[model samples]
Target: MAAKRKSNKKTRKKKKQLIPPAFIVGGIFFVMVLLIILAVINIKVKNLEKDIKLEQSKFNYARQIEKDIKAIFYDLEIDKSFAKHELIKENKKILLKYYLKLNKNEVDTLFYNIGNLLKKEKFKISYFSENELSAENEFIKIVFKVSRFKKSANKTNKEMYLKNKNNNHRLSIIIDDCGNNINLAKKLASIPYPITMSVIPFLKYSKETVKIAKQHNKTVFLHLPMQPKTYPNTDPGKGAIFLNTPKSLIEIIIRKDVEDLGFIEGANNHMGSALTENREKMQQVLNALKKYTDTFIDSHTSTKTVAYNVCKSLKMKCGMNRKFIDNVDDKNYIREKLYEVLSLFEKYNTIIIIGHLKENTIQVLKEELPHLQQKGIKITNIKEVLN
Candidate 1:
């Protein structure tokens, strides 16, 4: 019986060694935990994939919308009719970015298109930001650099009427060569307006002429005698600027003539068809007159004369006669020419008409000047026009 008991106990021990209760329980628990973890990981991965697909769809949509808008914009060009369409397209772009967050690829395409469009319309885009969209892409906000063009357009509009209005304007009248007839000069000077007297220096009544002109509140000038082309015998009188005189001598002559005039306001050329064209003579004359503080008017007998250029260089006030109203002294012809001059003034806004104190010219002026002022054409002084 003892041997039987030992054998039974050994069998029991072997059975116990073959099966461990702790290990069996632990294996079952580990398998259950691993299965739960795998299920949770699978669900998370599937959700991630869905989110990626949705984002891709949104990106593709943004791209399509942007392409459509760009096509429409290019078709519209820049016109009044296209303004509303452009605004609509811009709003659409804004909404797309706000709602779905435009794609990176779409955003880049939109920027390129916007830049091209702005360039076509001569505009500049100002607003852009990285956080414009909720996703990896954002919409661009564009504004034009309008201030520069706004000012330019405003000025252009204001000046639109200038070209039309400049065509018809009238200015003052100036009579040159007044020393020959003191009585006639006095009559011309008494015409209720500032008549300019151009007296020959060293003439018999030169001093008396200027005094009488000053007495009548008239402006007087030295009709400085310059060498004429046809007649070297044409004397400019005492201290005249001749072609043969040295430049300094010419300067001294001019200064003396101005001083002889007893503070005259201005001067004009007398028989200077030859001397006026001489650049050297003109430079000396201009320099000499710089001290007297008076202006010069070229009778413009020679088109080749440098008097105009010299006057400009010396910074002197100068006038070019629009026409010689009394070149022939025919009363009817003078009237016609004066009328033409008035028309020219209306057309050009200003005119300088040089005439002599001839009887016919004076008579026509006396009759017509008052009528002209009544007709709304202002007869201003030459100095007024120059200013």
Candidate 2:
């Protein structure tokens, strides 16, 4: 019994010595390190969240600036030919250098209008002059230079130039989503304007609409469906290209779509808010387009789109949608959109406006096209756009 009791005491002592002091210290140190790592990861996660929010906010501000610029140009009646934009990237911010050609009166009007607009938008005017205007906010910076308007050297050229200034503005009206509605197509065909019809594949009357448009002397564009940002749920419909789709698969998809459209003169994205942002995917898409069609237009659904850059790199002639007309099905909204279209001519030597082939859209065009023609906006075909 005495031996057993001694053994129990020794066992207790052994149990107490089992964990060395160094081991205890090491365990505490390891726990502290783990906690520090966790804290750092938590902080990084929060920072990432803040970054995402900031990016979204910046995108919103950029869109607002685009609208403000559009409104300003329209109000000033500045010719698009005289206004140009050069993008500069620095420290993750895009600086836009606006080259403007304006008369003294327009310059005066610009300052008065822009000064008020910037102030309302919480921007500070960094610099102001008769020839230059600069403004900045947290997310945006604006600088525009007004150059002297060039005059024709000879009297004959000057006279001719004045006579055809409006005609020089090339406008292409692309009627999108055409295949589903043959009656609308029929109505559009009867219209005198050289309308360009962009038909989506796998629609009820895909080939039939193409035939109709061709018969009516209309230019056809393959309305290439693509994955929008809200994909999987939004579903860009049949024959749409997804970002995850392999390059080889994209080529096959595009080829089949092109062949299905039955000789498209040009192509444009149907709903490519997501796919246009992927540079590699866009390169593949544009290459496929280069095989069958000469021209492509970025649908401009997403501001982050690299489609235009990719298209230029591939040397494929391309354009982008300046604005979407008739997004709302209302006649008044469309009329307002068309009214805005008139002002675009002053800024763009060539631009294409996209609209759906709905009944209301057709009606609005028929009513407003005559007025546009009267005002010297030439309603030309898509081929003329690249020219």
Candidate 3:
């Protein structure tokens, strides 16, 4: 019995060493709490991801609306009537406004076309009035406004049409030797006409003259210097390309003169009476000029000049002055030349006239330009004349 009791005590000790019921219950509860925490964290993460995706979708939708609107405008052909497209920006949306100079029927057609485009894009659209066309979703919105063009109350349609028609006779005038005098060039530039200003390279005010002309929307030209028949006695002055100058040197000199101006649409000879007569020399000059400005206007200093023919062969723009109005520098002669040039308009649509920057010439121009403008003789530029 004593032995049996000792054995029973050992067995009880072994049982105590095994896990307790309270500890098992506590372990199961702890595991359940950890699982609940993990499940809560996972739910919050999934919700955040869904919110981010929804925001990205909204952003993409907004971008798509912009692209769709751009496409709609790109497909439509614009004319003089669609004057202005003004954009007004709100916090996160854009209001597209167009001030159309169109008739009521045209405005209606434009709105109708835009509505059709948005309908295809699956956007819900509504017309606030005949004037407003808009499409909206929860994330993006685009609006287009239309209005019938308003004409000036002062002028009738017939009068405006006639006025436009009368302003047809175009004369391109080139004022030469411009860089010699700053004030004189200023006066020439201030004539309120788009005359071509020809500046002699390396003159005291060459760059300034070019700048002033450009400021006034005038065409600028490099008055290139070249050897004349009386070269030794009558210097063509600085930057003159002589007959003896190698083709490579001639090109370099022409490039410098052109690059110096920074903005000359064309070039004309200062005095190339001898140089122009030589085909090989003129070819070299034209070849050099072709690299800079393909357009060349013969001062018509020498009738033997092959500049025009060379330009034609090269497929370059070419023009020639019909007359040098201020050659004599007499006011009366200049006046007569003006009338003569004006008379040529009867036979030709365009004529080019060349003149010097003289006080008498400036005075004549100031006195006559307004009258010429009144008679619908608009002074154009060399590019227009060449065209």
TM-score of 3: 0.56
CA lDDT of each candidate?
0.61, 0.76, 0.72
Residue 263, candidate 2: how far off, in angstroms?
1.9
Greater-lDDT candidate between 2 and 3: 2
Report the lDDT tens digits of candidate 2 across residue range 1-387: 999999999999999889888998999999999999999999999999998898777767776676667666764467889888764544665566789887643553454345445656777667644366677787778888878655346444324434446777767888888899888889988888888899999899999999998898898899999986544434677888998988899889988897787779888998776789889999988887888987998766665679988988888888887777654455765676666555556577887887888788889999988876775668887777863
Task: Give the deviation of candidate 1 from the true structure as CA RMSD.
Answer: 31.0
Query: Ranking under lDDT, best-scoring first?
Result: 2, 3, 1
Return the lDDT, model 1, position 317. Answer: 91
- Residue pairs clashing in model 2 are 79-346, 79-347, 80-346, 80-347, 80-348
Candidate 1 lDDT trough over 10 residues, lowest sum: 142-151
* Estimated TM-score for each candidate: 0.54, 0.58, 0.56
Question: Which pairs of residues clash in candidate 3, taking residues 3 or more apart in a chain or in different chains?
Answer: none
TM-score of 2: 0.58
